[model samples]
Target: MAKQERAVRTRRLILEAAGAVFDEFGYESTTIAQILARAGVTKGALYFHFASKEELARGVLDQALTLEGILPQESRLQEWVDVGMVLAHRLPAEPLLSASVRLSADRKARDLFGTSWPAWIDFIAGQLAEAKAQGEVLPHVDPGATATLFVGAWTGVEILATAHDESGALEKRIALLYDTFLPGIAVPGALRNLDTSPDRGARVWKLHQAQHHARQEEAAAATA
Candidate 1:
């Protein structure tokens, strides 16, 4: 059990180190040696987890559409909002996600490896569709189209924010984006109830962690 846990931790460390390198140098410019240096792990250890740099890049891309820091909400729209807010909060702090975004935007990298954009669009559209079924969306809103637009807009904001590298810029821009789009897409009452706060991500993440710990405790109790 300890060996398995150690292997898992080692793999995660390598991925995170590779992600930081990719975030800084991009996929094409990044090298396995650099990743090894950053990770402080042996080449054999890295190869055990991931065969190559391309595989590591794919791993990063795979994480692009995560729900790691989200909690369920009564409002489907609010659930969707929490997803975005949590992502916004995490993007700056998490190198793997930032690297994924960087790789997705690079034309060369896209030709070599696929991106997470389509999946993200589909996931958001799915959420919006559920919200629509619940009568949370405006009459004329098309869930898929709106999802595509949101994904594009968010990516654009991320690019600009990355260039600026200003603190809280991404979160603030994303919050305003929801504020601008929600009125047109959401039912009036739902829109009024929804939160687009820049700090929403932080709050949701805390709740998510608490819920996860509670679940872990319950599972341990059950086993005991």
Candidate 2:
């Protein structure tokens, strides 16, 4: 059990180190040596988990769909909003998320290792579809199409916000986007109930952290 836990930690360390390096330097410029230096792991250890640099890149990208900071809401549309908001709140501080975007933005890297955008799109579409089924969305709304465009719009906001390089800009932009876009697809009742505030993400993140810590404590007590 100890060995398994150690391996998991080491793998996570390697992935995080790789994400930071890839975020700073594009995938093409990143080297195994750099990743090892950042991770403080031996070459053999990295190779044990990842056969090659490409594998590391893919591993980082795989984390792109992480829904760690999102909490379930009464409305699935609100959950969808939370997804974007939480990502916006966390992306600046998270190398995994930032690195995923950087890698996806690179055409060569995207071709070599497929982007996680499709998975994210599918997840959002599932949310919208469920919302529609629950009568949260308008009858004319197409969940798949809305999801694709929303993803595109979110990507654009990410890029623009990163370019502006202002703190809290991404969150604000995403919140504004939800505010503007949701009204079109969501029914009046659902739209009124949605929380599109820029700070909604921060609040949700804090709640998630508190719950996660509580879970860890409960697990420790159980083992004790």
Candidate 3:
């Protein structure tokens, strides 16, 4: 069990190191040696986890559409909003996610590893579909179209925020995005119930961490 945990931690360290490198230098310019240096792991250990830089990049990209901070909500639309809010809250602090965005935006990296945009779009569409079925969305709202637009808009907002070095204000910007957007697609009743506050993402993430620790404690107790 200790060995497994160590391996997991090592892998996480390598990924984070790779993400920081990839973010600073595009995938084409980044090398294994740089990753090894950043990760402080031997070359063999890095290879054991990832066969090549491409595979490592793909691994990072796979984390792009995460549900980590989002908890189940009464309305799926609210859940969808939480996804964007949590990302806005966490992306600045999370190297892997920020690097994933960088890679997706980098033409060379995107061509080699493919972008996570499509998967994100699909995930959003799925969420919107559920919301529509639950009558949270208006009848005329098209899930796929809405999802595509949201992803594009979110990407633009992220770029602008990063360019301006306004990481601190990103949550407010994202909340405003949902505030302006939800009214167009969401049913009146559902819209009223939705919370798009700037601090919501932080609150949700804190709750998620508390729940996760509780679950871990329960598991440990059960084993004892």
**Which pairs in model 3 have colliding backbones?**
none
What lDDT score is found at residue 224 in candidate 3?
Answer: 100
Q: Where does model 2 exceed 4 Å of error?
A: none
Model 1 segments more than 4 A misplaced: none
Q: Which pairs clash inside model 2?
A: none
Q: What tens digits encode model 1's per-residue C-alpha lDDT throughout 103-203? A: 89988789988888999899889999999999999989999999999988998998898899999998998899899889889988888888889999889
How does each model score on TM-score? 0.95, 0.92, 0.94
Better of 1 and 3 by lDDT: 3
Scored by CA lDDT, what does every candidate get? Answer: 0.89, 0.93, 0.92
Candidate 3 Cα errors over 4 Å, as ranges: none
Per TM-score, what order, best first? 1, 3, 2
- 117-149 per-residue lDDT for model 3 (tens digits): 998999999999999998899999999999999
lDDT head-to-head 2 vs 3, winner: 2
Tens digit per residue, CA lDDT, model 2, 1-224? 69999999999999999999998888899999999999999999999999999999989998888888889899999999999999999999988898898888888899999888899899999999999999999999999999999988998899889888999999999999998998799999888888899999999999999999999999999999
